[model samples]
Target chain A: EAGVAQSPRYKIIEKRQSVAFWCNPISGHATLYWYQQILGQGPKLLIQFQNNGVVDDSQLPKDRFSAERLKGVDSTLKIQPAKLEDSAVYLCASSLGSRGGSPQPQHFGDGTRLSIL
Target chain B: AQSVAQPEDQVNVAEGNPLTVKCTYSVSGNPYLFWYVQYPNRGLQFLLKYITGDNLVKGSYGFEAEFNKSQTSFHLKKPSALVSDSALYFCAVRDGATGGFKTIFGAGTRPFVKA
Candidate 1:
């Protein structure tokens, strides 16, 4: 089975520029997530989507960060007017679903590394 | 609110020696604990998780974590450290009662296994 796929493994942009990262999750996975990981910090949940509907996005910076999981398959996370603090890795993950009591481990993609000048 | 803490910023160990990375969590109800490892410039990889288990949960790369409810701790351990195992480790937790299922992660700990 193919792992989660992410485009533009590395990206560099100036501060205040807009950037977007795309992710294609593993086939048959129903849950998709986007996370931001700063240097020396763990990945933080930016948004979560259960199919096309969002399940949680409390941590997302609505003022600048936005994500969409259209068609319940692939996802895109966009950061407009990126700041210096936004220079970090963006990780995407997916799981089977939430219906079963079993806890499905999240499979992650290689992630896109963003560097803001 | 749920949170996780990794006490050590970095841990150094020699090959064939035991290695441990400490983690503690705070949650309102039963917690779902998890451990993830990240290599250089890579995404976080799931190692193991503890969700209503026998307290000792073994995971990939010969790693295991002990879930202690009383101490609110879930420490990752490997009996014999391997040089290839050097990487960043993160601890995470989720609240079970609310079904919110949003994970809270710790400030990662970097493990350096020397040859």
Candidate 2:
């Protein structure tokens, strides 16, 4: 089976610029997630989607970050007026279904490395 | 407020020797613990998880993790370390405190399996 796919594997932008990263989740997957990983740290959840609706985005910096999973298949994460702190790896993941009773593992993409100068 | 901790920033093991990476977590409900490995420049790959029942859960690439509820720990272990096992390992737990399924990861632990 094909894994989660992400494009623009690398991006560089000046401060206050805007950038967007795209992701294509695995087929039949109903849950998609976006995460940010900084150097020396583990990945942190930025947002999560269940189909075409958002399930969680409490941690996302709404002032600069936004994401949408249209048609419940592909997602795009956008960061406006990028800050130096936003320089990190943006990862996308997908799971079989909901985050319900049984636990499931998430399939991940290679991720997009963003650099803010 | 669910969170995980990887006590060792790095672990060094000789090939063919047993290797262990320590992990501890803090949660408000029944914990759902996971272990993932990431190679250089790659995204994270799931290794194993402990949601209930089994104390020792085996995963891919000869990896296993023991879930100790009493100790609030889920330490990753490999019986015979291989040079290829060298990579970054992460410990994660679901944010049960908020009654949501958001996952929180720890500062990764780098494993160096010397050949």
Candidate 3:
């Protein structure tokens, strides 16, 4: 199966500008996740989608960060008025879905490297 | 909430030498653990996981991890390091008891294999 696909491998924007990242999960994957990884830090979960509906977004900065996974296939993560601290890599990952009370390991994409100028 | 920790920022070992990257986790109940590797400019790849059954779980690329419940640690180990194995390793944990099923990742540890 093809791995998760993300667009615009690199992006650079001025502070306060808005940007959006796209992600297409592997075919048949029902669980999708968006993560933000800063330099010298591990990836941090921004949102999770179990099918088309959201299962978790507690860590997402609702004021500036928003994500939508319509039809449970493709997702878009948008950062409005991006901040300097938002400079990081945006990663997309998918899993085979949680079954029998167990969650599977996620397969990740190369990710979008974003730079705030 | 579940969490993972990688104490070392980086580990250096010579090629063909044994390598071990330390990881520790915290969870309210049974912990679901995972090990992932990330190459430069690439996404994280799953190397292995520990759900249950055994304290030692072997994974891809000749890697294995030992889950020590008493120590609250699940450390990644490789008998012989290779230059290709040099990359960032991340440890993750999920608390099954928490219906949310959210996974928390630790700060990554970079492994450098000197040839």
Candidate 4:
């Protein structure tokens, strides 16, 4: 099986600009997640999707960050009016889906390294 | 709120020596614990997980973790470490009772193995 795929291995832009990162999950996966990893810290959940419907987004910066997983397959995360603090690695992951309340391990893509100037 | 913690920022050991990375977690319900490895400029790779069976779980790359319920810890251990095993290790946890099934990761521990 192919691993999760992400585009634009690297990105650089000035503050206030807009950027988007794309991700393709593994085949048959029904759960997708977006995470932001800052320097010297762990990856924080930005959003989570079960199929096409959102399961969680409480940690997402709705004012600036937006994400969607259309058709329950691929996902895209957008950051508008990016701030200097927004510079970090954006990771996308997928899992085999939760069954009977048991969570499965997630498969991750290489991730997009975004830099804000 | 559920959380995970890796108390050590880094661990150093010589090749052929045993290595251990400490991890502790807190959650309201039964914990689903996991260990992941991340190389430089790469995404996190799943190494092992402890859902419910034995307290000691074996994983990839000759790694194993002991789940101590009383201690609320899941520490990764590998005997006869190799230089290639040196990398950043992350411990994660999820509360089984939580509806979202969200996973929380620790700060991560970097292990440096020298030959």
Clashes of each: 0, 0, 0, 0
Winner on TM-score between 2 and 4 is 4
Estimate, for each residue in A14-68, the C-alpha lDDT of model 4 and write its tens digit: 9999999999999999999999999989999999999999999999999999999
Leading candidate by lDDT: 4
Question: Candidate 3's error at B96, in angstroms?
Answer: 1.3
Query: Candidate 3: what's its TM-score on chain B?
Result: 0.97
**Model 2 per-residue lDDT tens digits across residues B5-108:** 99999999999999999999998888888899999999999999888888999999999999998999999999999999999999988844456878889999
TM-score of each: 0.96, 0.96, 0.98, 0.98
Worst 10 residues of 4 chain B by lDDT: B94-103
DockQ winner between candidates 1 and 4: 4
Kindly give the stretch of ten consecutive residues in candidate 2 chain B with the minimal lDDT sum: B95-104
lDDT of 1 by residue, B1-115 (tens): 8889999999999999999999999999899889999888787899999988599999999999999999999999999999999999999898887778688889999888999
| Interface RMS for model 1 | 1.1
Model 1 residue runs over 4 Å out of place are: none
lDDT of 1 at A35: 90
What's candidate 2's DockQ score?
A: 0.85
Candidates' DockQ values? 0.76, 0.85, 0.90, 0.85
Show pairs that collide, candidate 4: none
Interface RMSD of 2: 0.7
Candidate ordering by DockQ (highest first): 3, 2, 4, 1
At residue A17, candidate 2 shows an lDDT of: 96
CAPRI level of candidate 1: medium
List the candidates ranked by lDDT, beginning with the highest: 4, 3, 2, 1
